[model samples]
Target: MNEREKGGVPDDALIRMTLAGDDGAFGELVERYKGRAFAVAVGIVGDGDDALDVVQDSFIKAYYKLKEFRFGSNFYTWFYRLLVNQAIDRWRKSARSAEVPFDESWLAEDSSPPDGFAYPRTPENLARDRELGDALQRAVDALPEYHRAVIVLREVDGMAYDEIAKVLGCSVGTVMSRLHYARGKLRETLKSHREG
Candidate 1:
């Protein structure tokens, strides 16, 4: 049974239950958010295995800090900030260890078409799509950390600006500015690919 139907408990209630020593409540929360958390982490870190590690580490850190969480705050938002920070830390460490080049063949297969528009499945179109995807990934990887975070949270994770600001601990205006800059950089990068 779904956790909601199991006891009709909201996330805050679940957090309280977890804090009260109910590990099952926390497990339910983990089951609910793991995929989304992974998505956010993978978008930031660009590697599935590393992203998975980030999510696990983030959850462990969140568990330890649960007492410090303000009771009325949105649990996901608080948890998201932790997740993003942990993923960024993982990214920084990996960046120092090795600089792996972006490879389109290595990207996960679930990427959607830009703006929800579908491209034709002709062989030529498929090849072009692969090229575009590679170009996009390379461009995203080249972005600065703040800009990259804004792009991943907004475009990759479909987070609202205020929500991204909350995750990043920045003003909504900063989120907007960063997103704009990131998108502009992406367009410029892709445009070169198109011309060449």
Candidate 2:
């Protein structure tokens, strides 16, 4: 068994060991964060393939810059910032290209809708539900980068405001303001659909 598992080492300790040449420590760190990191990436970039690339690129960048990480701060927050920034950068770079639409197939396979409204199995209900989901995704995709980042981190990833502030390199107030603005925009965009 790996020393990390045997010792129940903290992230900081694992990081220190990784920097000191114990490669398995870094693997442990990756194992611990991979799911959250991938989710953060997918939230920003919107495409599974692009999100996967962002996660890989972020990890590679983190590995090289581990020594520069501040010792006292949360490692996950620091890594989250890296992952978020990489995903945003990728999104910006691909802005001109045809965006690969956000895939919602996993939502059905993995669990019920976030709203928990189980639509009847009729074809019309299923079609309308799919349409609504697509519309919501488009509304989110339309948000400006800063607002989108805050919304995804807070709502999609269930990050606390302070945690998001840390990951976004901003104050909690900024995170709140951005989230409010993003939510307002989404409301405006989806209002007509709801009324109809």
Best by lDDT: 1
Q: What's the TM-score of each model vs. the native?
A: 0.85, 0.85
How accurate locally, in lDDT, is each candidate? 0.84, 0.83
The residue pairs found clashing in candidate 2 are none
Write down the RMSD of all candidates, one decimal each. 3.6, 2.9
CA RMSD (A), model 1: 3.6
Model 2: runs farther than 4 Å from truth?
1-3, 96-122
TM-score of 2: 0.85
Please give the distance, in angstroms, between residue 40's alpha carbon in candidate 2 and its true position after superposition.
1.4
Residue-wise C-alpha lDDT for candidate 2, range 1-196, written one tens digit per residue? 9666686789999999999999888888888888888877877787778888999999989999999998999999999999899988998988542333534464455666558676555668667767777777787778888888888898888999999998999999999899999999999888977887
lDDT of 1 at 153: 85
User: What are the clashing pairs of model 1?
Assistant: none
